[model samples]
Target: MSINAKSADHSPIDEDAEQLARLGYTYEKQFKREMSFWGNVSLGFTYLSPVVGVYTLFASSLGLGGPPMIWSFLIVGVGQFFVALVFGEIVSNYPVAGGIYPWARRLWGRKWGWMTGWVYLIALLTTIAGVAYGAGTFLDALVGAEASTASTIVCAIVMILLATGINLGGTKLLNKVAMLGLIAELSGALVVGIWLLVVARQHDLSVLFNSFGAGGGSNYFIAFAAAALIGIYQYYGFEACGDVAEEVPNPGIRIPKAMRMTIYIGGFAATFVCLSLILAVPDYAAVISGQDTDPVGTVLSGAFGAVGYRVVLGIVLISFVSCVMSLQAAASRLSYSMARDRMLPASKLLAHFQEKRHVPPYSLLLACVVPILVILGSIVSPDALVVIVSFAALGIYLGFQLVVLAALRARLKGWKPSGAFQLGKWGVPVNIAALTWGVLGITNMVWPRTPDSPWFVNYLVLLSAVAVVGVGLIYLFAKKPYTHSDAPAADAVPPSGSNRSVAENAQSHHVENYL
Candidate 1:
């Protein structure tokens, strides 16, 4: 039996365990000592991928080149940081695997939490598909292979399966693999970026700063706004660290620190890469015009020749694949956490962890299978990846907004968590600011692009809206909320008496696992 399941005979199954049984599952604390702070941070940071840097090419294509693109990235990065802080404060205090879902419930109430959880869950799943599909596209570019919808779909499935296999090996293995991949990704990006900057040192850096009117045809603000949508996406996925807070030791301290590191490091790295790619462009028009294939690769091929181009392509592929793996790890933990809470159907199966592996085998399997199908099925339309990614972003934005608002309200009502991290006096204003920015981003993303808009990319405002509503409805009627004491096998002891946060207890069993 897993170390956690073995613990069942020694101690009384807590109220939480009882609740888990209602959903047809048994809670197993299977993942412990599996990830360090840096490893967890790396998982979240890798998701940005080349997607953020490549976003600049699209920005340029839409006519919002020059200073505007750089400024847009800066603006989005800072704005998103506020949201991260809100997450950090709560996650550190709770450090539970349910993450946004449990935080929402604690701060708001059961009904709102249930609704928000579904949206967060679906968004996370779709985000996995979007990142995996992008990995396939980058791999295709590296191999000089033509990627049709069918080919991309098949590649996505293959990549997802590989990622799942890695995760099934347990969090320790997953963290090690993720750390290695992260180093390669960052190292490769830096090598190319620095090399390009050094070679182009004599070029007029001012030219890179000059703003070009949206291709001379679209609205300047709207163009910049569109670029901001792309820019803002780069700053996300930092919260993935919190979803597996239970697996990390000293989670109250480590989880918050890890989250802060991800936000600051990821934000700076994304901005640096975006700027470096733009400055490396010998001819912006040529780079922007080649979106039919790989715009970033086109620029690299011209600027550094075939070898340099191939190297960049290879790095992009590796980074994207790493991102897919990281997403699977996070998504599976989220599903497992929710299932253990009796909030999802088939909870027993979905939440089960293997004793010898100390891994959520079923959850990992589900996470991998769902994304492959999503990537394959969604590849038929033009700009399928962009639409899906944006659609996924909307869900994340909503979840973040809700959590921030909930936290603010809870604090105002005198709810103070005695924990390792607390915002003190700055919490309310920061949360308010975060909420404003989130609302603006959602509205801007949903706003349609006009024929005269600088960014010509199609928006999936309607589809994204439909998805959020659909998820909310499903939660309203189908998902059931459970009391902490409802589960049969869990120690239902309150956090105060147990000296363990819900997340720590849920994930503490893996520490003794080596088999």
Candidate 2:
């Protein structure tokens, strides 16, 4: 049971060890071990909840109608396929702690890489706020707690604190907690979806195709585009799997496989949810006019009654909590890795680890703190949170777009993966398509409406632009550069001395506080 004992059980470096030896620290790796393949898949699915998928389906139905919204998923899928392919290449080649940011840095340059990382971090943090905000609304609706800002903000802070605590134990605990949450959520969604589809008669497919304003919009494409954004939202967190390269066993193969499986499973689950909602329009108007509080539960209550509705609401809360875990894990690790490389401030503190838990404790604390502050700040201005959500979504698109472009740029530069999960010859084309689609999405986010415009989406554009530029400036001046030597080889470092960089002994630095 001794920390240094290299026996099969005590060794920190193992197929399942959550805190791997390769992680630099005098602290022995003592957290829970890595997940089994099935465990990983389940965790990923939970983080990417299908309940949200149905929510998106209804949103799209309102704007673009059911048929067009489905088409939007297909369209976004194709675009994301390219990005995924490109990610496949980079991850396969250099699966490490820092993912897209490092990939961008390696393929592009230090300046650009930092820019990518900074924007991605901002986006992620912003999205975390959105999730917390949404979860607060759901919590209020399901339990009928005091619906005041005080209650919502406290609830959000508690959720973030819980996620941080789970992650402070390292990846294994995070995965296990996340898996359990996802299972509860997904099971509830599956039940609702199947029940709805079975009980209701199929609607006219052609009617959905032709209904221009099914949700009350005039233009079909605009409505579909808006709704499509919702469907795509459910698939957003899969990229987090790659961010944990330092912990994933045989990351070269495993990370890519996990990424692919995450998308496939998440996509399939989402599609099922979308289909069920489309078929089970027990009350389409009610679903579309969904409130910030317990919208999905409201729809379920109408269809399945109070008992059934409560169960679904419970599942939705589980899903939200699971998502919070996933985001916290990804965001904190990103901070740890970035700070470890001197890319963020106070590297020493953010990168510190607890020997018993074998985790970046400071990073977790800081991450939890900032988001709570953000939530509290939201109490003063509700609309500000909406702007934050849009900004965060835009940040993901911007960062990923560069990563996709980098993948293409790398391929064009003649770089290739030396392992499994190749996108074959289709890699380059797929990446290009992903870039184009991602860009289009970012554009929509930026200019959702115009001042003189008919629809009220112009402010979205202005807000997104301000967010991008504002965040970009911080990266340009504040963050440090990542060197070529900073790019650690995939699986190059072994257990005991694994964390040693090409430059020197792995420096004792603190991780960032990004929750």
C-alpha lDDT of residue 100 in model 2: 80
Residue-level lDDT of model 2, residues 1-515, one tens digit each, is 32223565644345323223333322243333365555556655665666654563355345335445666666666566556666766665555565787677656666767777877877777767777766766677677676778877877887787777778776777767877776676677678788877775346555456553354665656656666776556666667777776666556456666666777877766777776666555445444455223334444666778666666767777777777777777677677767766777687898776777667788777667777777777868876776666677677778888787766666665554443456666767777788888878776655453347645356774556576767677756654345423534222122353434221222122111110
Off by over 4 Å in 1: 1-28, 50-67, 200-203, 215-219, 286-294, 378-390, 451-459, 478-515
* Candidate 1, 202-291: lDDT as tens digits: 245575455544435655666667666657667777788888776676665667677777777777666667667667655555433443
Give per-residue lDDT, candidate 2, residue 420. Answer: 40
- TM-score to native of every candidate shown: 0.83, 0.82
The CA lDDT of each predicted structure is: 0.67, 0.63
Candidate RMSDs in order:
6.9, 7.2
Worst 10 residues of 2 by lDDT: 506-515
